[model samples]
Target: MGVPLLAIVAWSGTGKTTLLQQVIPLLKARGIRTGLIKHTHHRMDIDTPGKDSYLLRKAGADQVIVASDQRWALMCETPDKPLGLTELTARMDHSALDLVLVEGFKDEPVAKIALWRRGVKGEVADLLDGYVIALASDKKLAIDYPLLDINHPLSVADFIENWLRTGQ
Candidate 1:
């Protein structure tokens, strides 16, 4: 089996994207090959008109791929709606990824690191297990899980590295 994945979920302004921007690069610096799968609650557009991939998809193709000397993009359009993490990962090649740092899907079976800014803590009733394995915050809260310094991405990145290298 491939290395297990974890989703990093938190409130909208809790710095999830900012933290990922910091952590992902550090993980790569440490030689960890990571794959990311982001779940958005809203519609998004990664394609623009006249782009080769866009044109192909407009021609009734279910999936369109465009690659160049630098990067590649794959757009899959369909009415098929998939369930949680298991179904999602099945669409990807797990062998190529050591860890999948998913950006959303709070209620998924995968482990999670909760993001909470010091003063912005939410009511604790709905945010426990299958929710937070750790906290990335500006100040320590009364939570039980390990506390992470969100400002220090290396530490967080190291935590992810260790979690993947071992079963912590």
Candidate 2:
């Protein structure tokens, strides 16, 4: 697929994941295949500690690949060695899907929509720099692209769709 990757970035409480959950299926209904890459700053547990997969990870392998009848998961020892933003996009699968909706990687290559909920610390949005293609909030604001209400996810989703469709 030649469709470009897009990202939804926001602070802890700004609803990045929720927004993606709403928009992705909408895009899917229109025949857009989507995939997601999420980031976790804190330690996370996937495999049960006593499970075989957990044992393998404890054995110190740099990468762990697990597959089963209906699912698969990969755990990698990826450090802070991001090859910058653009290079990270190149490392993902872009050939078989319409879009890869990555979460986090705010410092990486692709353009992003910054979910700016009001009352959240400005420090959060401040980190995004110019990567913000649009801003979403529950309150109204005179943003340059389009001011969107956080509760009305439809408009935000539409914004993303129009951005991609018009080759913006």
lDDT of 2 by residue, 53-131 (tens): 8998889877788998997877766565634545555666677677777888777657777777767766543745676
**Superposing every Cα of model 1 onto the true structure, what RMSD results?**
2.1
CA lDDT of each prediction against the hidden true structure: 0.79, 0.74
**Which runs of model 2 end up more than 4 angstroms from their true locations?**
1-3, 79-91, 123-128
lDDT of 1 by residue, 1-168 (tens): 665788898777778999999999999888887788898888777899897778878899987888889988777775687456776777777777777889988888778987777556574335556556777778767767888998899889978888777775
Worst 10-residue lDDT window for candidate 2 reads 82-91
lDDT of 2: 0.74
TM-score of each model, in listed order: 0.87, 0.83
